[model samples]
Target: MTRLPASLLPEGLTAAVEEASGARVVAVRPRGGGGASRDGAELDLAWPDGRTASAYMNYDVHRAGAGDDASFLREAAVLRALSGPLALAGVRVAPYYASVPDQRALVCGLVAGCDRFGAITDPVQRDALAADFMAQLAALHRIDIAKQPIEGMGPIESADVFARRRIAGLRAGNSGRAWDPLIHLALDWLEANIPADMPPPAIVHGDAGPGNFLFEGDRVTALLDWELVHYGDPMADLAMLCLRMLFQGFVPLPQAFAAYEAAGGHSVDRARLRFWRLLFQTAFARRSRYDDPDAPPPPNLGMNLVYSTIHRRVLSQALAEAAGVALPPVAMPDAAPGAHDRSFAVALDDIRDTIVPRLSDQQAAVKAKGLARLIKWWRAIERYQPGFHAAERLEISAALRRDFPDHGAAWSAFCQAVSDGGIETEAAIILCNAHAAREAALLADSMGGLAETRLAPLD
Candidate 1:
């Protein structure tokens, strides 16, 4: 029997499970080492019939007192509703339940165990695994929201609303900071430029990634974690999956993209995916800036760079898609930026004197000052503009939008030069100091795992 601190287990959770399943609870053990393990215990149940059961016990952090119990019950209701339907497809989920009236705790049954990413190397295993994942994704999307029983969770009906809400959250985080003007501009454009009508709403697994899944030899045995699940566009799930996979540097793009397309995924609007990709990049960049320095590198780093690189590639691809004209690959560095220099200083100087000075006085003065200083030293150009080689990465990205028609062709052409160089570079170095890093990256074999793909960083 595995013993635990009484406070962590709460009161009667053990008895509740025993009563619900009619299993004799002989021992409770803790399971760890997975991506979704929270600050709680994993219970292992031993019965007289020589069988065993396991459950996940997690502490709720968003509510108070009995409110936590209510939250778990709500999730449980969703699980119950999805259970029968999912079982038909060879899928099952641990029953999500809450023990006691405390608003800060939850206890859920843990389903059959399986291997993690240890088995993703084999192709047959990979395809079967991808198929199973898609089936679960389809199952989630097929849920009838109207009949579901979660209360506080709102209906996600419109892509416009989703975009707006996301933008709003980003703006709120910006506050009166110096980056507001550029941030605000992007947010406004996204809000006004939403697709005419997105594919109808479906329940989405917001954080669909390899890390959150348990695979038994390429077969996804379980899709773990549901905190971010909600009713929304099916594309949202696809985007999340792509973003997660690409960020982790798992494999080739053609393979990943094709796998997704083969899995009954038909919605592939370039503009729609591009929008989410850009939004995901911008949001993640800001988040990285605010995260704890000691924490693991943000998953968004590679993605941010990929978006910027693609922005440039898109210009060429757009032309190719429309005219069958294959443009030269730009010589863009697949690396981060470098330290302060004349070009960077010049860009910052422009933002401070030209851009910041023209902003509305309604903004906070202190934020303006800080932003001015930050802008002066903003050697972060990978996400903003990734098409330029290290030699001029900062200048091109900073000027790409601002300079517009004047530098458009020249900028794009420059990116083509870099893209053709065929090299891998560090994301941070490319943004901070691309000029020096470009040559080295071109000679290097891997550029942030982008390979021969025309990749870039997102905004």
Candidate 2:
């Protein structure tokens, strides 16, 4: 535990934590963020008199490729503030301890609770927790952000202006990289559809939803993940809750909204909520995160592919819903077995049977599981990518009324058309949804629970 192995943390962090805590660091264990961008660790410290205490440190030290460190510092500031007068109403955040700004680490007293809200088997138990969490969101939104000006966070503005600034930054960040046409289209559409309403802005848990908060038994313990916290329309948080429910199941939205309204939160604004829902979904699907230094790269790149497929599909569906279009259902492809099927099967067997059992290191076992997901995806690619590619090419050519010699060329042209307004939004969306659906089917087996995601109705 005294060692600063590369797997655990970068060098100097150990020293920084020790200095900040005024204690000897007896141990530190890696604690992965379930779906959030941050990485965390459990640090056990000892004082001079044989007294020891445990603290949790949330950090991201593996971002060696990117240049920014602003987000982590900002989160530390939020955590510090929330522990004081600027805190959310009736909600509990982790107790603030110390922050090592140099290494982007925040140390805090550890609390015990499960972040997995959907895994609870009893529907009544899950409903009770969901309602309590909903009330927590209401309490959070009731905190007038203007009175609690957080340092380094962006200016509080109307929902339209906030969306404008946020979407503009994402568009600028993703401009040249342009890997996903759907993102290009969705961002553009979101830009064009910014809501005109300006309700009282509140300190919203920007990524508020299922899995973002924690509960123990039937009691909500703490709302987790303040990394995406910001001052915006409270309705935006409701929107985000709906989106997160697509992947991480939650109590019904009507039930959730009733809880929110009854708890003294702002009334649910369905229009603004839908707008922010699309905004958040497109934001999550962005290619710009790949370049972000704060974003911890997935242990397996295959998992990234798996996530991107889900995001793209859901994004297209969300966008189409906003545009009042029902996309044609995509046909499922018969995944004909390819030559590498046996190899992929063998690798999965080895990972499950041999490699994983021998991996005494928990981190290594997690990585092995991730690698298995990628191999399964590769197996699907071998079986179906050729047909998917050809189908996309035809769809693009038909949409644009022109032909391209290569799939890459067609993709580039389609995205360009989306950006330039040369093609009908309906046509563009249909094609984008089709492409996303095909990729979803390709990724379904590998994605496990994430494959069958359905957007909850924003009633």
Candidate 3:
């Protein structure tokens, strides 16, 4: 193995070419980020017969440690075993000696393929992309996992554990104050109704969706990004795919399901599909509340998924009552974006600038808790971070009270005082506290919020 320049590789990875193959590295390139992104690189290598070709490399940030090399080798082995039979396959990654000192980053070959997101706007392209995705999924599902134990993967067979883990991820990041009561109630409801049993699990690309693949015209040139691969019920993948579709607002629900089924996917029981769909959607709703940039553009150009989820619940209940069915507790709140993106943006900026700086001195352990992190963030907002203009914060707080009337009598009384045109200085101070309180509450309250009363329901 020849030593490559440290400057040639990313800050964390070690690079070398195989001497036996007469492969000599010649060049490198860089790429961008998306849903399941690994940074990209292009390697021009000279072969033994005086011929040269380029092999693309992708370095995933998640697999940055030495221990992960075996797991990655296993993933590459899975692809290598299956690539030959699939209708199309990106060149399966080749294992190379890793010199990565950090255990949180990775580097691998890049595949030159087109993105599907760019194609969704075009009709012919969308169909072709869907066909490619379905074909790839079917091929992946058909693989025989009974042979060697695929390392670093496990069976997520327990319904109780699955639900608990999902709920924990949500709660783990929450500040346990005003929002805790409602979030806990929702969790309790979900726990009581944990489906009795799930179907047999299969090898699933734990996080599968359109954005994770690459398209060459209508055909999938490569199935990119496999970090979350695991063994799970096939319906989990199916439900998540449909959820992505809905979030994209591409078509009617039944039509999307019909299209998927037509693309060679076995149609699971509709009820089961709906169960997984709602479960995945709720997880998404909670995760999106944290302001992730990559989440499918808010279903209707809207930012507040908490408001959206709650509004959906209200409608679901209203419809159930109309149909003479037992209406479950429509306790789901309106999960809408804050009345002004500006406020959230302002708050977030304060977190980045003022809050993070002061807390730079805090131990990383305290920084890990969501509430502690948020409180540290709020202290920054009140002092140096101008989360909301003084007058604006007051107005927003008053508005939040009306929008989330279920925030109980305490909040109602507080908002009532502000709504009555109180002093700007007093109102601003109160609103700042309320703003922090509400954010803390939302994290606790199942990570959602109410829709502003002024806006009509989205169609």
Candidate 4:
């Protein structure tokens, strides 16, 4: 929804588009849903003989230093490599046009479809579309990594190594900063249980899920968002797909799994899938923190908070499953009135009842709703956060057998205690469950009767 001003376009972009399309650039408009990591636009170009064409442009503006550049180039290379194979398989991937690494921009041919796949009403048609998506994923996994030799993708000895590398990178990313205890615990679990035997690595779409793809009716028009493409176990993509569906409510998980296997995906590995699910949810929860200086700012603070709350809850569920812990039901905290509580509530009502309805831009309206939810959350935080933190800190201190000034310090101490065998797994699981439950309760309080997905306890 955030449109790029005409003045913000780089001077050479027009020339680049002209050279690629053999036409003069006529106009450009920013596209919606560029996501937190990139900016996107559609360019209108005119040929010399009065013909015209359109192309998509993406700028990798969320550069987290060199790793980002490597990621961009790797995606570009993957797109280039997979173009022929994907087209042959009737999978619609946007054709690669040109990439300017210096400008951190890439242009590709526009594909026809929208990202709202869940809008399709016919259950049969939706199932067929889901099957087609699985078919495309199966085809992608069938790609011979050795024969392709994509630039920027290095070989790993095994999927286990690849998983470990990712964990290490996350740790490195969080170095010298206060760490989240839940993330540390998840990492420990993942490290302890890397699937010993696994299928050979295949090209994995690291971010494969509903929102990343486009569809028209029951058919998937294009599988978009290749920023996380890499060579890895295909289960990574499958796990990501199911995790996304779990949150989106687009398809039944068991049915989707059957379709995927029928379409030639590897046999279902429930344990490994669960492991990857925990990793995916934890990674996203950490991202919701928005603490990385190198990452781009979220579209708005409200959207970020909403994302954080939802993912944190999901992460909690995943952690509980992995740790074999039963989380107690989150009890609502007693609300204490603050001086600004009434004002915040009034502002939230105005945004929901007045401002959002009046907004002409659909995307702006959506953002307004998110802002309203954020204001409600702020009210809850004001009332409950201090008391909740105090209680949780006391619990963590008791578990660790040491006191700390805050949660972060206590978590660090607890992680060390676990590493040194001072704290047992069962004890850690209890503390983690309590911590997660309290956080989820705070988030639920913030919703103020708004409907949100409630994650079920692990079986």
Best by TM-score: 2
Better of 1 and 3 by lDDT: 1
Q: For candidate 4, lDDT tens digit of each residue in 1-459?
A: 234335546567656656755776666775543444555677666678987667787775445222366667777777776665445545568877677776567777788887776677788888998888888888788766666566555553467777888888766654445466567677888888888877888888878878878888777777887877767777888778866664454567677777888988788787777777777777776645355565565545555555555666677767777778876654445766777899998997899789977986544665677677677777777887777777777877877777889976776787677556678767776676666666656566554432356543222
Quote the lDDT for 346 in model 2: 91
| Candidate 4: segments with Cα more than 4 A from true spot | 1-5, 8-24, 47-51, 64-67, 102-104, 151-157, 287-296, 349-370, 401-422, 445-459
Q: Give the higher-lDDT candidate: 2 or 3.
A: 2
Ranking by TM-score: 2, 4, 1, 3
What's the TM-score of each model vs. the native? 0.54, 0.90, 0.52, 0.84
> For candidate 1, what's the RMSD?
14.5
Q: What is the lDDT of residue 449 in candidate 1?
A: 45
lDDT of 4 at 156: 37
Off by more than 4 A, model 3: 1-5, 16-25, 34-40, 45-109, 117-125, 147-152, 155-164, 168-186, 246-253, 278-459
What tens digits encode model 1's per-residue C-alpha lDDT throughout 1-459? 356434434466556656655665555554321231133456666656787667676543323111124334544444554454434534456665444323334455676655355345676776667666676676566555656534444444566677677788777776522232223334544566667667666666666766667666656666766545555676666666655554343344345455555655544565676666555544533422324454333212333233333332232233233233433333553444454456756765676677666854322232344344334324444222344433353455453333334444544544443334322222212322333233224322213344334332321
Q: Model 3: per-residue lDDT, tens digit, 1-459?
A: 223425545554433333323566665443332232234445566656887666554454444211245445445444444343432332222333222223223333345675545346778777666665765675565554555334334443454466566666656543323233223333433555556666545566655665666666767666655554555556666665664543333333454455556756556555555455545544443323335443223211112333344433432332232233452221222333434545545665665666666653222212322333343334434433233333334445454434332334435444444334343423333343333333433333223223221112112
Those runs of model 1 whose alpha carbons end farther than 4 Å from true positions after fitting are: 7-40, 45-52, 58-77, 84-91, 99-106, 113-115, 144-153, 176-189, 247-265, 288-459
Displacement of the residue 333 alpha carbon in candidate 4, Å: 1.4
lDDT of each: 0.48, 0.76, 0.44, 0.69
lDDT of 2 by residue, 1-459 (tens): 444433466678878888887877777777554353455677787877787788887666664211246656666777777777665356778877788877667787777899888789999898788878888888777776677677766576766677888888778766665556787778877888888876867777777887777689877887776666777889988887887787788877898999889878898889888888888778677653545556567434555666667777899888998788888877665667989899899999999999999986555676677788878878988999888888889889988999999888998899889878889989988988998898788778889988988888766
TM-score, cand. 1: 0.54
